[model samples]
Target: MTKENMEEGVNQKNVESTQMKEEKKIDEEDTKEAEKVNLTKVTTFEELLEVVGTRGKWNVLTFLMCILVAFTSPLQTLSYQFLGATPDHWCQVTPLLEANWTHQQILDLAIPFSNSTGRPENCYMRDYDYTAAAALGYQTTMKDPSAVLRNSSSLIQCSVREFNLSQYISTVVTEWDLVCERRVLYSTTQAVMQGGKLFGFVLFAYLVDALGRRPVVLVCSAISIIAGFLAAASPNIEFYIVLKFIIAAVDAGQYLGIFVFVMETCASKYRAGAGTLIVIPWAVGYMVVPGIAYVIRPWKLLQVAYTVPALYTIIYFWLLPESPRWLIDQGRYQEAFKVISWVAKVNRKPLPADQVVLAAMENIYHQKAQGKEADSATKTFTSRLLNLLKQLLSLLLISELRVRTIIVFFCWFSASMVYYGIALNATNLSTDPYLYIFLGGLLEVPSYLLLWPALIYIGRKKSLVALYLFCGLCIFSVMGLMLTYPGEAEVAKVFFSQIGKMAVTAAFQLAWMYTAELFPTKFRSLAVGQASFCARIGSTSSPYINDLLGPYTVWAPSALFGSVSLVSAALAVLLPETRHCDLPESNDFFTKTKEAGAEGREQGVVDQDEGVLNPSFVSEAGETGSQIHPRKSDTH
Candidate 1:
């Protein structure tokens, strides 16, 4: 080797070393700048909340006010069972009625027995009437009308319909003639309302996030009130559909605005209890709705009766305050300060200095900006879809997150399916629909009563498994007793179905918090929200499951529902115990982020470069359940 050639190689190596040093220096500067912006945000809202106090006088007052107004959602929603209820109807038989045949006599001579139901056919009946027999004075209160009408009469379609208005003065079914083959329209009303709710939850949330919670809530409340009134005055089915759709759609605001406000205002420590308390009013409203309908009788009057209470919320416009976090985000720092200061003053706590409030707000703003930057990278519809798909794939493909995602999804799907399915089956549960509904509401109290302690002591996993298994067992009992014992066990079947409702209702409520806990903060909201699509599918098909499958067998819907609950419980075994574990640090913890520093390390969460939970992160999980194995080091 020549000295010159060896020297040239040495020079090449020295130059490469220098370039590496310079690049390292530049990277350090960028890292430092990011730290300054992010680490400085350690003064979070929770810290500021400590000084202002969480469960102070102001918080309690706000909680009570919110609770009072909580009636709007349940009343408007649950009352539909009776208002849109289909009544008992049959052929009109005007000829016999005009000819002085009794209503029962006309029904006996005109309507034919159904081979399937073994009761008189609602849609089809004997073509012949008892007009001639009535005129001849052969059949009376003392004589049977069936003896007068020939048994060989051919069946024909009734041009007109008659309804038994003894139970209800009028319902949508009677008014619209939605009996027989046209009954699908009755189910459609419910579907359309549910569809509206589905659409509204998504749309209203976006608007609330963008427009401030108070205004969106006010608008929703006002619209809901107006829509409720207009529903009573609806001239036709089309008008009723549109109005009810609006009512259902706007109800999302009631959920998001009022409930969310109450949640945000209360101390984080009391969240589980607060949620349980809020539901107490809702259950009460549901219980009372049947009584109102029973007394009002007329569907239109029932509509007004159900709607009158929400009118009290007209006071919310003056009383409701904007969320301090939202105020901080909007850069309305002074307003935020004033609101918190007022809270502090009312609670008799020391007021926060403006600097402390501003500093906290600044930290929050920077943190939110970091989140925005992550989200802004994918702005278009296609990009968003691709991102969601990628996140979903990560959840399924990744080893640690996969089981939790699958289990959570099934929990959501089955809970919604069975919960709503049971609620909607009230009318069919007994001869008295009111009793089924009242008992449903009644049982909810105990179920929700059991929820807080069960979650606190039993843990999320065990509580869910026990509740679901018990529920499935009850449903299976209902199916077996109905198929086996039939009439003698009628009361027993209703009892079991009602108990099943209780278990699923608790499970349904528990899923909301459990799903959030299973995921990390990065994608927690997305994970929680996406699961609703499955829930939506479950809820939407529940009515149809009961309606479509009933003729073939009474147990078909319960069979499907019970099996789903059991399967969901079984899937839960694979989920890791999150009771003592922290939420996942990042959506895709496998993809380590160069920017993650003390914050990520502190939470024991691996940093990722995404917005939503790779699974989804729950900021604060209310209660916890069992997990198979938990380690002190596990972040999520």
Candidate 2:
């Protein structure tokens, strides 16, 4: 062995060890710096609320906006009755029979009895010339038209109609003479409008996410105002129906845009309350509808009345502000800061003076600054669309989220089906449809009032389950009453039916807010829009279910609605309870935030990191759901 070689090797080993020590020291410093950054991140909505100040001037403005905007939706939607009411109609009796016989005698002598209704048929009449019969001194006594005709060939159908509108001043049915074969067209008019609503929910959802909430809302409001007025002046049924469809298309944006705006604007503590409260105006509008219809009594004038109120929405352009959270999410920090500053000024609150940003906010800002968002932003429309497709596919593709998504979708579907089913079919009840509708609207107030407390205490999942179960029970009771009493117990049937409607309305509102809370912010709008899209499907088909099944068996639609409600309630149990829980900001919410906290605590990660809590711990320790402790710089 050479002594010189051994010494050289030992020196080389020491040099290598020293180099490794220096690198390890540098890495530890970087880790500490990273931990410092984490300590400053804005992790939850509650922390954001701290910066914005909850329940201040900004909340009041957005709250008022929510109510005012929500009012326009139901008015535009349910105004069809006033615009298309079909008054009692009958065939025009020839002058020969008109002179000799009274109107009743003429109808009895000419029109056939309807097999389904046992009333005088509206279209067919005896073809024999009454003038010759009158000249021959034929009696003006009443007889069944079919009996007098003696053969099918002797009967004719009247093309024009005389409408007996003792109850109504005017209607589209009489103005256009849409009767007999055209009777079904009125329902089709309503159906087509619902179809338009179905499409609009999806369209506005995309626009809301792609564009911005404020602009889309204003654009839709303007369209609604214009379409509503044009519809009022529509010269014919076709024109009227087309305009109605346009109104329906724009109607969703007014409702959903404002709804999402309010949900996004309010602090976590007030989110549920805000969601339920916005529907009060809708209930008011629902109740107000029948009164307006009663007062106007003329279709065109009623249309005009419905159109006028929506004009106030234009003022929203000035009143409303872009959602700051959404802006920050989209990498538009300057705009977000501007909105926050405006809100601060209006709210009389001061912003954090230092250039310090929340750790979460900083991370997002850094990513955007590093061109993570820019590269995607620069991608073509096709690429963006494909990305959207990929995102949607992920909803069903991920096992954990897939179940929640599917169940929530069903909840939305059933909630919508029962809601619109009872709402639209209220016309067929024993009571005057106007009064019935008013009562239905009145019931919704208490329903929502009850929802606020129930959601806060009992929790969203349980409250929904209970509400849906109660709705199903109410419907089932109505069906039982109908079956037991058959054509008799009208009072009991109507009362229970209204109760069912109230429950369904509450369920619908819950589904809206709960579904929003279920998904992450990344695709919340798209998820809600998809849920609403399913809802529209249920709403669109409700009429057909009622009409088609109603004739075969009076209990069919009610049974169907009740059955679905019950199933949905059961499905709700499988969904993760989100009430009072932190809303996930990212797609890996349950894992990265919640599970990470648990894992970090187990692995002593929090202890090693000098007691800076993980995201979930931060959320739990803050004011309310998803709130996080603020950094020193944020105290200002």
Candidate 3:
């Protein structure tokens, strides 16, 4: 062959060879991609099945913890009831003072005249007029029959007549004043509960994030047991309030700890439902309170009745397991493995040991990488206080975080107002407080049941809005009944109020679920705490509002709560629908936020720069067993 022809022929061969090599490389890449997709599909299916199968164990533990945590709700209601009963004793003393006995004479007779030595000289005279004191008012020394006959003073006479007691050794000193003392005790008890709730939220939220949920819950249970016993056996009102406060504090810890534990352990799809279900036990506890109050009769015994739940904490020591999700968060792989293994074993399934190891490694690596990125992006704290403030600001500024906090606050405030308002006014509504309370609580069951389906199908916003609107309508209806036929239809008015109670109870249950869905995993505990804190503010304020307005004043709080519910409903419109949305990983969240904002700005609806949505500001659902679409543009 000629030299030129040989050169051309060789070049042609080389070109063909290169083309063949490129095709082979492309085929290999395609094969690898296919394998990766298949692997992901298999893993996703396995996760779904595993999560579904584990539901039984999750249900058991959740139910148990809920029962433990629920004691506080009823305790709060009972404390209110006990406080109301204080006037009973003072009411009993009125008639004794009206029975021709001088205030000095009544005081001389009522005060113990002899000391332990049985000597009159050793006795100290009591300063207050025991016989003349009204149920809950200032005392007057005047014995003018008409002055004594004033309706307020008549409370004492009414109590004396009811007890059928005499001037000397009268019910005024023993029963009437004792009731007043009991009132003071119960009031103190409530104050302790309030303090406990405040401290519990702050302490347990920090502890749940720092030490993990299981330990806090266990410790809280122990404290609850001890404090409960102390409260039950308290010899005097002073001791009762002190011990009750301690119990309440511990109980508060138990409350938040259980919530954190349950939500962390459950699959994301089941998280909202599980969170709402926890409130079932709380409703049950409320229903149980009136029955227990009837059985116990006295405030001290009622305290004991409430305290008995603390004994259940012993079961937790043996049965409860540390949350696998929390362990993973803390970078404790071995511990997470053990817990997951136990879960698998309990469910009669075997998890491949290596799969567990691989999953743990992947999670840790991903977390570390994300942490490095976040560290590079965010500012360093100059001091611990600044760091805390930074963290707080981060928590508050995040749209998902702030929205949930605000919504929960409104829900809680509204729920507390309506729940307590209905409960406190139960007597005004009907003679059967037990029946009324029981029905009110029983109605909440459907609410929880409805949440699972509503959340699964309709989404968070629709369900929450429906509940809020329903509650508002119920409140308005109750107000109408109270106003339109004030004294004519007592039966109908009471029944309508009960109906309102049921509606609000259901709304409250749904609110718990909605709040859980609105926070990211990292700040879940804090978000829940802040929401709870707002709720407590509502709970704390409800009593004062109720007292200031009276039973008929239910309309005031109902209207206030209704307005809040409407605002929440409007805010719900602003949030992205979270139903079936997989929890976003930390990285995916910010990327999507930027994409959404960019798209929004391109539409020219507003200044794109001003309205940019920060993905970091939105709480992302993380690794939930749901398909999430990539952000289309900045506009979303």
lDDT of 3: 0.55
Error of 1 at 97 (Å): 3.2
In model 3, where do residues sit more than 4 Å from their true spots? 1-53, 56-79, 82-195, 235-239, 354-361, 364-382, 427-431, 551-555, 584-591, 594-636
Candidates arranged by TM-score, highest first: 2, 1, 3
TM-score of 3: 0.71
Please give the CA lDDT of all the candidate structures.
0.68, 0.73, 0.55
Ranking by lDDT: 2, 1, 3
Rate residue 569 of model 1 by lDDT: 83
lDDT of candidate 3 over 85-143, digit per residue (tens): 42211232344455655544444333333333243211132334444444323334434
The per-prediction tally of clashing pairs is 21, 8, 23
- lDDT tens readout by residue for model 1, 1-636: 899999999999999999999989876774454334322334345445656777788988888888776566667766667887766778887666777767677666667777656667787777444555656553452265555555566787775788888756789878888766777777767766766676676566556655767888889889989999989988888899888788887876566656555645555456556666777777888789788887788888888888888898888799888878567766688888888878877886654345755677777555444433344677789998887566545557666566667778778889988887888785445546788888888889889888887765556677788889988999988888867875456688788999999999888877766665566444444455555545666776777787767655777888898999999888765654444333343443323222233345433343221121222222445221111222334321
Which tens-of-lDDT digit does each residue in 8-47 have in candidate 2?
9999999999999999997677545434432255655446
Which ten contiguous residues of candidate 1 have the minimum total lDDT?
608-617
